[model samples]
Target: MDQPRGVESAPVQQLLNLLVDRLDSAEQRGSAGVKSIALGERTWPALYMAHRESEKENLWEHIIELSCWGWLVVKPEVATRSRSGYADSPRVTVANILEVRKAVGRSTRIKSAVERWREAVREGLHGTDEVKAAVSEFCIDMPDRSMAEVVERLNVLPSLVGKELLLREVSSQLFWGMSKVLDKRQGLVAAVLGVDECPFPESPIQLQVFLPESGYHGVLFIENLMCFERAIRSKSSAFDGLALVYASGYKGGAQRLRTHDGCSLFYSTRGGFRQDLRASFEAWLFSKDVIPAFFWGDLDWSGMRILSVMRTTFLELAAWEPGYCQMLAALIGGNGHAPEAADKQGQKALDFSGCFYADTYLLPALHSYKKFVDQEQIRF
Candidate 1:
């Protein structure tokens, strides 16, 4: 009798060849259905065992050994029977087997590709140290500064530097600068005669003044900053005739003046005069014979409204530039646009016979010219 072929040798060789062929074909097809069942769905045993005799060969053990050797292998399948008598069958189609094999190979390739990209990025970042340092510096938090100051400082930085990083680094400095600007403006009224630094009275209505002469007394009030600055600079010329007793600030510019030296500066917190101080200031003005006083502000609707408030306190108050006829003349001389119509409430107010010079001249001019002129515009 011919020597019987060994139980494992021939079949094992054939099986290995078959497995290699199947894996190659699966790679060519590039599908992962077999991997989904084997790895994801765990259907490996069903995929490997072709017939009952293959079970005795311990095919699963060999497959596991192949996996350790770097071959893409399927997981073992576990089955169960439900109360409904339906068997939990695992999918073991040849197509699924090939697909799983291909998927495993593709996954390995993708992981390797990603690692290469990450390494390249790491190397690139390392090469540019200056840029990295600048970025870190910019991201650091700083105190706030004003926009003007920030712009001024950033201009000094090298052009090669990133603007966004610079801005972030100096944001706080910019904000602080803005705050300082506002403080300077606020300190304007008090800075006159070095009075802002002086101590103020507890009551809001306290009146004080600093004059060259001891006996000088008068009621002095400013509506806005530019006009207030002009008045303070020309204090002697402006408040010459009056006793120079009481001084006050109002609106944007006026609220910032200081109350230093002997002069007490009263400013309105909101738009109109402070209620607690209003009557006191008016009484002081009347007592000091400060009637027919000069008033100056912008030549806009809002400016007129401010003048109207002053008029309620002092009937003799007269506007400096926002007079009705004066503004009308200015509007006519310039090639400017017309002003918009006042709303119903403003129209009724403007219709009053006692309306300011702006009401008579500027309002009508604005209606005709269809333009608005601010005080700053006239300064140039």
Candidate 2:
């Protein structure tokens, strides 16, 4: 468990960091370039990966340490070889980048999980049989997005997957949102071809989940849970014809589903947008151009960023201007503002030209006021 000093050295870290991106690119493109990282002594990858102070002798030592940790088996004897190793160098890649740290056990654990998940998916299994596979999807299929997070949270994944359909829930927005036709299967027999219940609420949602769900003509996403609960409470009147959902805070993401939705509604934050649900949400926009989707969040720098990020996906994502006006009026003396920190966060201060909210209103007013207006100001 302790990292060897040399292995922990800047040189080794630089080397690995360079390789990580390359490996990811290679894997995504289905290229053979990842088999071995070709690093010449004068090349940028090698120089960037090499430490400022490491000499040739010390460099080889680091390689040995990395090899000892199973990152790559090194062949340090040749000059034609890359800084990490030559094309035909004895140092062959022995494992994945994720496997480098826990060369002994974590690798095996992750490997087993991936294998189990592969088998489970193949067998159309659910529950414990399906949990590892879902996590494995994060670990493998969506590697760039979730591998590190999944690896860091692997121990908790099993229990988390027990009651929550983490993967499938994320699948629509994260993996299947771009779908024209639903291709996945859910539960024992349900394939996501039509109406289903939205899964954002921790409890049962009485509303249906497909696009243009019956009476709901539009969808509204709130950032906070209380707001979502409040919206849901308005089911019979004002909120009718609106599939209201909570964007699940800054940590919102796509759900992986065994069965995918035909048309999925996407909810995301600055942190979750394309990284989490951009594609799926975009697909929804592409499929249903008529449905109006609005994202309402607090009036702050982050809120602006959230709006900006959401706009990239749903160009129609507009400010709840009427509600925003009401929110400001209800404020003390109609004197409005965002947080102090938000005011100083210059990006928030910049006049967001061509903002969907009539360009000159709402956001500019908030910027001028320099104060926070919680969305909860408007009750259900």
Candidate 3:
């Protein structure tokens, strides 16, 4: 909506901008010819959500003022009963979509960059999910970067620009945010560039060995460093004779262990870990007796997914019950944080972790409490 003289406030303007955008999108989808769009319709839930947010900011009255001034048409509030079936609540409906679109000066719908790119690469992009997502994001988000230019230079991906060129060229934000895209879908990049494999930069396998004098009995991968460090320092009998490896949040790339030189272990030579012990560690890691593999992380959805991901490689891998059980106890004891608080807002509530303890105990506890506990919270 136009900044009405002497009336436009920040919250009101933000609310109007959101409303106009929502209405404009509706118009783009054939709402231009239609007369009125209900604010409560399933298709327009965002409109209702925006209204509710404005209500919380005490900006709805200012919005009503704009409607009264003929800035936009908002149907008169209809009185409604609350969900409790007791209180009176009023529903604000948009009287017309065209009028709102006009207010924002959104004219004839034009194809977005993504749509144009999709049309151009019609059959070419059917290679892999990662390539498709990365290419679409490049076209839509990076207005200056040309996908055509990148495709033409795809042959020089690894040799000229280094292995991470495709990922680096696409978007730095996308690379780190969805780091496993290249790891999982490198085949598509290879196929496009006519190479056997995309030689992407790889991080050395990091491990914090805690093998006893008698030799390690099992391997445990800890997701977060805090918990990994805590587990080592705890001197708990439960972790005795277990080799602890800090997972470092590498999902699909963790499976690269089977590749030649993939198990190039990273260690601090200055510490107790001697340079000569590297070969023995690597050998034991690849040995058949590397059974009883366990993963321990936060009590969040992503943590469970990490366990599921590692399971693809370590088929025998299961959730580290002791660490997870402690987190579960803390969650049930009301000592956990909301998903938003931990920046885990995007983590989907996965029902299974391919491990009985996680699927039955951890997942249910997280779903029941709607909360997450960091593995570091449990010292023992």
Candidate 4:
């Protein structure tokens, strides 16, 4: 009963996957055929792999599920809820992390590496080198593709930015400026979706969504698909929107706004914007008279980056005003952690440094923690 009735949580499984690696690495020399580890209560090795507050919160509820799989053992005599005391030579193994998982509760997500990769390729993510690299580098050690860890590794790859190699159909220098810098483990990779000299449309483009028929104050662009879909359906003021666009995985869907009418504002769900998509945003902002545009994203470098992109160098954007700013300041002032951007696309921390003038004091304090504060958790 400890393991829930259906699918396991992605975050919990991710944690278990990481802990298994640690357990495997720390195995003793003269042990039996069984390879396992010992975990002390109130210690980090027993909890989330990430030492940050945000990650801690994610894996907090699955202690029982892990116990059920024998992946985690708790002393019946000790406070189980506390995840306290010590775990003796436990039976937990790498198999616990790699084993087939049941469809717990509402989740029917498949965690198999082969199956997932096949699905990914079918979904058009088969960019030869990327798919190969993801398999060889990430899954080679452990074929746990469903693990959130693998997903994060893939997200940061230049492939996620949807950039493709350009054939030398023209002078390479002319196409250089079209590239965007993407942060990677080795450093940064300059990504170019298409060479300017190539035929008609160089790359597949997702159009900016607009509800020209809907009456409203402004346009809201959300990073999360669920949230974007919910915005138009709900009449609640908290999620109310005149119109909305889904900026899927930082691929800003806000297309040419000049064709559409301006409202009170234009904003995003998460932080940061790429150069390839900035021109339309610029035109959207300065079209006629300056209309109000707002950006409400997670409280992290990435979110701030999106905000910086929205604010741009020419125009300044206010924090969800005195209210959002005050809330953000309170979180940062308290040392809210800024977890390294899981899939950071920008090469520099201050990718949009020009907007720093408005909130210079806020960045240093926020950046120090290097943690992420999800906007969905806080009640606005």
Candidate 5:
């Protein structure tokens, strides 16, 4: 695309110069390409101020002209808007670097970093079928990120890291400053690197399960640690045939049971004995004859939310009447603390948890009292 006539104003020329400078810097750093570079305070503060000052005089006519010329890509497609609506600043990036360079009379071609990164990726494609598939579809598209650094990380995958390592450990070894580079594209990283069986770092939150010695009848998910410890210590007759599982604030990992790796939860943490116990627990959890499930947590909105979330995995999960009844009695007697007192001011008031026990008895009590009682308050 050629530069349009009558759009060669000073501001427009200055903006074009800035784009060329950014492109040259990107080339030096081996970036794939820039995208969505905000033409605001962050990227071009000086230009932004100039635009603001010139607003009353030129009224962004230069921006419109450059955008109309196809030399710059303005967000919101402002080409269709009337002049009155162009008051606010829109994000802008070079639509075509070659055209911008030509317009600025600096048409020197530089080899793209994306092509180099792609070649490197292809060269390192000697892994399994899964790796090959992921690599073939891998894209070098993150804006302002170095493709060379990514290539270096990809190259180190074969020798630097071991199988079944945590994602954080790999990230730390890669030393990509605060960014969990491996964590983002897990499938690609896992396949290309053979770091773990599952693409993601296994859940660090372990489910502290106590399988009943007697025949299994049901399961109770305990939310807090103290309550879980208490349940194990008590060994009450009420929990005789029920398997007790400590929820451990699990929200996402529990949902993975419905996926291809139902047993991956067991394989998450290291150790053979621990793995065996988790396997047994997983098997019993997903048995054909659905076991009755119940949840016992704090009489607060967060607990209710956890129950509602975990219910997706444990279909029959509901509020445990025995525990909630105790909590409810405490709340009604004004034995509970206010939301602010308990640092629960941020907790949202949940009106439901998809359980008769919760909907019928628990939610109403919490809403009515606006108080919370921890599960640990109730002994057994």
Candidate 6:
């Protein structure tokens, strides 16, 4: 005797597979209909009508279960009903089915739109009138209360309300209730010198110096904001004799330093370095013979990259604490940690074992299973 076939049988499996393939193809083409199943002419027309009218072909389990149980027979009552009624013509049923499909499609589109809006919010672009106008224009057909309710429900700032309105107008709540979890990290460094400000150009290169009453010049530049803030707050006696100037992301702080008698300011530009400014900066660095200049930044790849650029300007420069193991240990004590090895590209560019400069030191220290020390990790 042959074994009984369950839902897992080869023929049933093949049929299910065929149904899935057909459903996927229809979905991809934005249509609904099954043309692959083999049955009689009468059965085929009925099945096609059922598939098209139901528009639930993607729910293959229900359709396959009904077909396998031979429950797909067209009823007499259904046939008697007019084409405009519940058990109507294939075209009429298809219209209803398409109504459901359209609902689902609209929902998906709304979700995508909400995601875009949330992204704009995270970028601090949500508060603009342009975004509000766009939302108002897009959500015109949405029910007043339904769309307004969604906008109100979002905990985001008022600027994000327009995005919510636009999404609701399109009947999409896909990215709804998700605006609260965006990252808003600002990467620029901020420093406040004791002197008013320095004359830093609006360029990416910022060389700051701090001069104390003792006439010792503490020259440094930073790329990390929190680290810079902490450094200024913790006035080290080592910096007592130095004339310090800071290269900050803002022009006001640099400009204030210009008013001080002996202090100079170097501004940062987004376009790296300008030749004339670079020459003037180098001249300043080499001008004072007895003073030892220090450079400090984060232990990350970007910090190291900046250190590499600074080397071109300062020949006698050395890495401050957090850049080297000894200085880091002295500043932070035994709790100081070294950064992980440089990433593969950094390792190749800076063979850690071969050099001791600011940029090359991190690669070797990291390769030796040491962790990179963040400037923020050091206690004043």
Best by lDDT: 5
Q: lDDT for each of the candidates?
A: 0.38, 0.48, 0.59, 0.42, 0.67, 0.39
Candidate 6: tens digits of C-alpha lDDT, residues 130-196:
4443333322112333444443333233323334232222223323433221111001000111123
- Worst-scoring 10-residue span by lDDT in model 6: 185-194
Q: Write the per-residue lDDT of candidate 3 for residues 31-69, one digit (tens) a residue.
A: 654333343434333334553554433434454555565
Q: Give the poorly placed runs of model 5, Cα more than 4 Å off.
A: 1-151, 158-169, 176-205, 251-253, 257-282, 286-289
Give all TM-scores, in the order shown. 0.29, 0.36, 0.56, 0.34, 0.53, 0.32
Better of 2 and 6 by lDDT: 2
Q: Across residues 229-297, which tens digit of lDDT does each residue of candidate 5 receive?
A: 777668567666666776566442266444433333422121223545545556655553476878888
lDDT of 2 by residue, 1-380 (tens): 56544655555566665556556556555576556654555333444344553465456556666666556755444632444343333434546457563423222222344554454344442235345344335323343444333233323322333245434444333343422111232321121111253322222212112222233456676776777665654443655556565655432222221113323344422123333244443445445345687767766556666766666555667766655666656543554543554354454354572355625566666655666667776775
Deviating ranges (above 4 Å) for candidate 3: 1-109, 118-141, 155-188, 199-205, 208-210, 250-253, 268-280, 287-289
The residue ranges of model 6 lying beyond 4 angstroms of the native Cα positions read: 1-108, 114-209, 212-218, 222-243, 247-294, 298-325, 328-334, 337-356, 370-380
Worst 10-residue lDDT window, candidate 3: 79-88
Better candidate by TM-score, 5 or 6: 5
The full ranking of all candidates by TM-score, starting with the best, is: 3, 5, 2, 4, 6, 1
Query: How do the residues 273-364 of candidate 4 rate in per-residue lDDT, one tens digit apiece?
Result: 44433444545544633544445556666666666655442153444442346446657666344354445434245534344433664466
RMSD of 2: 14.6
Q: Least accurate stretch of 10 residues (summed lDDT) in model 4?
A: 182-191
Q: After superposition, how far is residue 5 of candidate 5 from its true place, in Å?
A: 28
Write candidate 1's Cα lDDT for 1-380 as tens digits.
22112213444344433444554455556654433222111233342444554453354444343444444333233321222111233222233333333433432232232333333333432224443333222211224533233324333333323334322233224344332321222232122113443122212233433232322233444444554444334534544543222333333123222222212454433213444344444454435345445455545555556666656555565565433344455657783433443332242223331446656666666556555554433431
Candidate 2 stretches greater than 4 Å from native = 1-214, 235-237, 250-289, 331-347
lDDT, residue 239, candidate 1: 45
The candidate, 4 or 5, that scores higher on TM-score is 5
Model 1 residue 194 distance off true place after TM-score fit, in angstroms: 45
Candidate 6's TM-score: 0.32
